[model samples]
Target: MISAVVFDMAGTTIDDRGAVYRALRSAVEDAGAPVADADLQRWMGTDKEEAITALLELGGVQPTPSIVSATFRAFRATLDDLYRADPPVPMAGVEAALADLRARGVRVALTTGFDEPVVGSLLASLGWTVGRGPAHTVDAVVTTSDVRAGRPAPYMIHHAMELLGVEDVHQVLAAGDTVVDVRAARNAGVVAVGVCTGALSRAELEAEPHDHVLDGVADVPALLAGREARVGVA
Candidate 1:
């Protein structure tokens, strides 16, 4: 049985209106190293710094510290501005799904490739604070700053598992709307659920190996038996 759930933020839970990508694309272009549209899409769900560096490498340029810093600073400023103008909304059915999961005694942890400041802003917008106590909406919030590496590396998922006191990976179910999300879950030896409510499409998500691919977060609870009448059923 899955006792804990790990979900990715942004596309996974909250809807940021593609602000992250816009920031990255703008920053890269401003840096005089525009990323190809396909490249940018491929790098989704990764640490911004990592993605920038990868883009640089793909462009046959070395990821100098100066270039990385400048690009990252630009990206952050752009994202902050976009978010300030309009705070993100939660993906359809996210809140209800989260509530249902919690009602089933399942602990929820939200993980993201974003660093502390970015994640903090999102949480604040949603009236969620960082803490492990029951008073918190989510059990925990794990960011890239909390790990040595981000998605596709499994460190983010592992960091969440560690903080949530989950020793066995199999007891966890992870969901996201990116390739790296599913890869990270599988890497951690847990259930990989692909949710196409945000970034990717069903066809793109199906290209990767996943345990279950659902339309949105709303269907998650039913799939997990959160909505089932366990007491009366045989």
Candidate 2:
């Protein structure tokens, strides 16, 4: 049985209408660093600061500390403005899925590439609470700001496990919509699931190493039930 499940925020659970990608592209361009669609997509589900530096380097820019910092700040400001104009909404069936998982005694945690301030604003916009309470939607949240490194490094996932009191990696499942997310789960030695609710298509996500590639976050509950049933039969 899976004791805890960690989910990615933006494309997986929240439908932000691709605002993050737009903000990232705009920031890199404003910093005079050319960013191709493919390059930017590859950096999706990663820390904003690391993504900026990587994009700058890929574009032949030096990616000095000052430039990276400036670009990151620009990205944050643009995202804040965009979200203010049009607040993010929960992805179809995601809130119900979260509630169902929690009701089943499965601990649900959210891990994201966003920092604390950004996560706070996003959650506030959705009116979702964290921690243990009747009003809470999730058990814990792990963000880039909480870890030294972001996706493709398992720090955030491991941190979520720690926070949720899930000790065995085999008892955990991590799901997201990006290659880095899958990589991070694999690096953490947990079940890696890819969902096609984000920029990447099912085929694109399937091309990466993953345990399962589902159509959306809503399918997660059924998947977990199937796994548990199989275990019971065994």
Candidate 3:
């Protein structure tokens, strides 16, 4: 039985409209490393700062601390401006899905590659921040900045489990719209679910070995309703 469900933010719960990719590409290029969009997309679910550092190295820029810091600042500014100009768009039925899980007495959390401030702004705009309202709420929110590492590293997922008081990875379900999302869940020994709603496609997500793949977030609760326990709580 699943005790908690962790979800990716952009693309998984919110309709990012590719803002993350666009902002990162622009910021990296402005910082003197003309990163390819495809390369940026490949590292979509990791920390943007780490992703920028990798891009800088890939683009032959030596990735000094000053350079990485400068690029990340630019990325933050660009993303902030985009959000202010147009508050993020939520995915089709994330609220309903969250409600369904909550109704089933399952804990819900959000894990993201975004930094804290960005997540706050996005959540505030949607009125889902802490103490906002009860209609759409999550038990916890974890970000790359909050963890030692991001997706493909399992730290964020592990941290989410910690916050939700869930000790067993087998009792968790991790869902996101990227390959790293699946990899992170697998690394944490939980069920990896890929959704074809944000960044990756059904075929692209299928390239990974996920426990389940769905059209979107709304299909998650049903998927976990019939799963058996693979391990006991740690």
Local accuracy by lDDT, each model: 0.86, 0.94, 0.85
User: Per-residue lDDT of 1-234 in model 2, one digit per residue for the tens?
Assistant: 798999999999999999999999999999888899999999999998999999999988999999999989999999999999989999999999999999998998999999999999999999999997556999999999899999999999999999999899999999999999999999999999999999999999999989999988899999999999999999
Worst 10 residues of 3 by lDDT: 225-234
lDDT tens string, model 3, 120-155? 888988888542125549989999889888889989
**Ten-residue stretch with the least lDDT total in model 1:** 225-234
A best-first ranking of the candidates according to their TM-score comes to 2, 1, 3
lDDT at residue 109 of model 2 (Cα atoms) = 93
Candidate 2: residue pairs that collide = none
Ranking by lDDT: 2, 1, 3
Q: Write candidate 1's Cα lDDT for 1-234 as tens digits.
A: 778899999888888899988988888877777588789888889998999888877766678999989889999999999999878988888888887888778888999889998888789898876565556678888888988888898888888888888889888999999999999999989999999976689999999999999887777888778424563474
What is the number of residue pairs that collide in model 2?
A: 0
**Candidate 2: where is the Cα deviation over 4 Å?**
none
Residue 206 error for model 3, in Å?
A: 0.4
RMSD of each: 2.3, 0.8, 3.4
Residue 196 CA error for candidate 2 (Å)? 0.3
